[model samples]
Target: MKSGVLKKSGTNKKKAIECLQDTTKNTIVFKIKSNYFNENYIPSSNTRATTNFANLARGENRQENLRNTIQMINNRFNSLAKWDNPNDDRYSVELEIISVEIDIDGSGTTFPSIEVLKTHINDHKTGKRIEGIVGNNFSSYVRDYDFSVLLSEHNKGKENYSIPDNFGELHGNIFKCFVKSEAYKKNFTKAPVICLSVSSNKIYNRTGNHHPVLGFEYLSSKSSLTEEYFEKMGLKVRYFIPPNSVAPFAFYFSGDLLADYTNLELISTISTMETFQKIYRPEIYNANAVAGQCYNPSLKNQDHSLTKISYDREERTGLGIEQGKFAEQHFITPNKNFLEQWSANFTM
Candidate 1:
């Protein structure tokens, strides 16, 4: 779907987001707009994170998905740690999904919808390393509901749509409301920053950068709905393929993502995103080398050779969709009334 606002759907309910354009068309970042808000409200823990960073809300087969997702998380941790022998515990990286309660409904009713990652890392002698933490790809649920579902659905059927004059403003405002919600304020210390894989179909030319960060320019167009939506979320996008990594990752955040996160956190995300990238976008990450005259990439027209990693990534795509639909049905769809309350009442 187009970026500024999503395509419309079967339902014609004039709910919260439909009016978002009119109510908050010129809003900016929550941190920037708020006169008295803490930048680091919840300081980054020296150990595992609060799970507020990227959480999974409830689902229909909630217990089952939770169990499977946790297993996936543990597997990801093990694969990245190179725990070749699953039976052996000499070297292990573990993640436990602990329940967190929050009022997501906007109404007074609470949902045990949030889950935090409690980590336990072992290195032969080093028993306890990180305390607790954790991703978009790694999320138990789709955290960017507005960006992924709401806006995308809103713009679906339109063939010749003009991005609103205040596209950034409107989009950012919706996110701003989400960030400033009471549940968010209570659960998170700082504002949110997340990462997404660059589209495989979009051709991106590598830009000059001395560090691990490899800048990229869209070979097709300067801006995309994804780019603008993220900018409105208060971050600029840059691609980075860290030292000794297989592929480039697009991180969206304000200031510097590398600087903003701790070394362990960075390692965790690299393990999460790069591994999945290696699986899902194998043409790029798994490529022996970029083919053709230009050393650049067209991931769809890829050159790939699978590397050593267990677990069937191809099988998990369906699970990802199921998880998303579950989150949308349980978390986002039911919350429309709340979002409406949010949209009509929100201010710049």
Candidate 2:
């Protein structure tokens, strides 16, 4: 099986603690509950050519969201490839997606633990694999199990229901284990870039530019756990509103998220993430006075800022309890059978 569980119970604890130290070679580890590895000691083998990074949001209308995300990707590619689109074909390059459910062990009633989506990107004319981007669409069985279940039990019945000081450490380490596997080494040529929504807490502003980047002038008082978690992962975060995009997106990467990738490769991720944001939070992306405004010759404002406001949050905490309950009912609970099967079958 792809799931790699160490057989020796005692060594598991040692291995878990060892992961807490500072990384030696582009690897970062952080403190988490020791018991986290007691049962799930080893990480998944990830033998399949896939990545756990997913930009999708939780809730109903998920399939529709996926379809829309694909359309956006094609549209964005065509826009960016004007030279390649003189005749206005379907796209300058096409990204087709295929997905399969990881039944964690195949015992789930019908719903799998999670689904993995892989995109095949090719040049429209040559039909050659030119863009090196694929593997998206992972569900939150890992999130549900790690955060909602394990973390809950770890801090259960505490006074004020206190959580550990290392709130995001466990998930981050598990994620590290996932990416560093031999399968990942075998599959890809570079480190992964994960794209997701910008913080609802901050108003993003962008300077008008043909090539884009974040204008992070308006600093916030505190960092979100999401920001801290990625920091612990040794990843740098940048926010950008892609050309013709409605809102900004938070991109986490070990290297330059922009420079490390080809234009079409980069656009593939941006399009998927931006479409995902628009679908899940219409109030944030669509139901507003503006989508993405391109200001005429951006000039320094009163605060000496070069950018203008793009989005601000009302009350949507991306990690709120309501979101958890929804995913648990729709995705996790139905896939419990698979988790059990996976647990029993796991071994070194």
Candidate 3:
């Protein structure tokens, strides 16, 4: 499994401690809850099974939770049906966070500078900027080459670019960053494994480790529409502080998180791959993984699989959610066929 900010058990508890100290103004204590599915501390002997970090770190239930989260969100949007034409039976919506983490600062007895949080939330909503909230003493995660490359490519074509490959190396780097960080790294061995099976090569095994680095930004208006986005739908943002750590967290910086475009990205996997741009899953395309494999490692194969699967093509739908780099984008619209395909797997 790729390293994460959340640990299983018998792991260090410093990061959580530091985070609580920074975020909670009043004296408060927090408990670290491991994801419910984590079972068995030791690894099995099977090579593939041992390597399947997604399966190993997070068992079936946790993965099901994430899948259900996406599924439920899409279902709720379909029920609302305001985003599309009433006549159009097909409708789908993509759900992703603006990606923000609260950095705890020890010694200082206060939450993130209200100004900084306000500015970050504003920047995220306006699609103008994204800044990491790192404490003065907090160290920055050294980004790998692939991580930087994916960001540059995704952000290149537009005034404000979005990372195209979510499941690629970008997610890996972010996980490592969180792992390496002094604040959140403790207690967590790696990020949660949400889903699995996107590239389909069996080369890359874990889900959350390869998940696209999702950014979470606050809504411009805390009014009904935005509040409803979370409150009514159970689309709540994940907020927590690492345990046993100090106060005064650090804020990292990034402009790539600011995505200003008419087109809200559903999933960039398709578009990015079409252009022959690099992807996080080099393993899938790697000479060894693709060489004489059962499925030809190409778009032709993907199209065939997609057709056979017969699922929603409009909304963000796919198997296996990757982390580091974004993948190809799949855009869906209002149509009965679209809605049917999206909900098809749900009842089953």
Candidate 4:
């Protein structure tokens, strides 16, 4: 009676693991070959970025090449478009990164430190803890968008797009985030739905370089303007800790607990919490919140449903407004009474 064997004598289908990979290699940030670069061109620390930049210097069709390069960059940016799969209900996580600003001293003095920090939620929550490793750790991210919501100016989605895999064991600056299911669901939500993964065991060690290097680099806990900005906005600082390579640390916030905000927003608020703190403090990233999805549970079974409504007229504007409003106003706050009032009156 080996594990995974069906009770009825001979079935071989395995029981699915409760957990799934939320990020994929394609979703995580990485450099791909630019067609402009010569076929043999291999970028490196010794080779100046201009060397690669100059690769696009063509003579007659230089304009065309420039246009193509611009388009290439645009395409990459747009590639983060929210996608949903039509099969699994559980496959509903989006990918996003905490916006961070850092001052890297190219003059060869010291490691780059975070200078500014900004996040998806700025007004509602301020000076909170931020998760994820910063400052020369193994993490990767990319920018993506979703069009399910109608307000072009605001660009509020039903959920905060983020991959849900955490690789705390990796010791180097390079790691991979992977996505598995194309299956997505939409029903007038604001964000895309996809699962992502953070995988580490695969290491790529470069020779001669003392500090570790990989296909990509991950930095954790570097300070950013996001924290200072949040503090300016009136959000309170909860936890602050110095960055550590071996220990776990994170920022936390307590908002008026409302039923409307999705679990994802709450999670991301914490994820970006450390970035909002005025003091440097060590914090532990919450594991459970990072693994959850932020879509409207009722709409998790539909594909192209959000897109369909998005193209429609009257239905699109007012659609999903309740969730959108909740997501916008209540990410991280300290008002428990307000949350109680809203929950008592919530009709939907």
Give per-residue CA lDDT, model 1, range 155-234, as digits (tens): 78988654544443533545555555543454344445455666654555544453533222223345667777667656
TM-score of each: 0.53, 0.55, 0.22, 0.17
Off by over 4 Å in 2: 1-69, 90-118, 134-138, 146-163, 205-221, 287-348
Q: What value of lDDT does candidate 3 attain over all alpha carbons?
A: 0.24
Summarize candidate 2's per-residue lDDT along 1-348 as a digit string, tens digits: 222111222233222221221232232222111111111122233211122212222235434444455555566666656565676443533332322122222232122222233344556676676644543333333454455555677778776765566555534543555456443444456676766665765545554444542322122344665677677556667666655554556677777765777766776565555544554445444333343442211111122211111122322333323334444565446645643443333221
Candidate 1, residue 121: lDDT: 50
Count of clashing residue pairs in every prediction: 16, 0, 79, 61
RMSD of 1: 11.7
On TM-score, the leading prediction is 2
Clash count for candidate 1 is 16
Alpha-carbon runs more than 4 Å astray in model 1: 1-92, 96-128, 131-133, 136-192, 201-203, 212-221, 290-299, 307-338
Ordering by TM-score: 2, 1, 3, 4
Candidate 2's displacement at residue 330, Å, is: 17
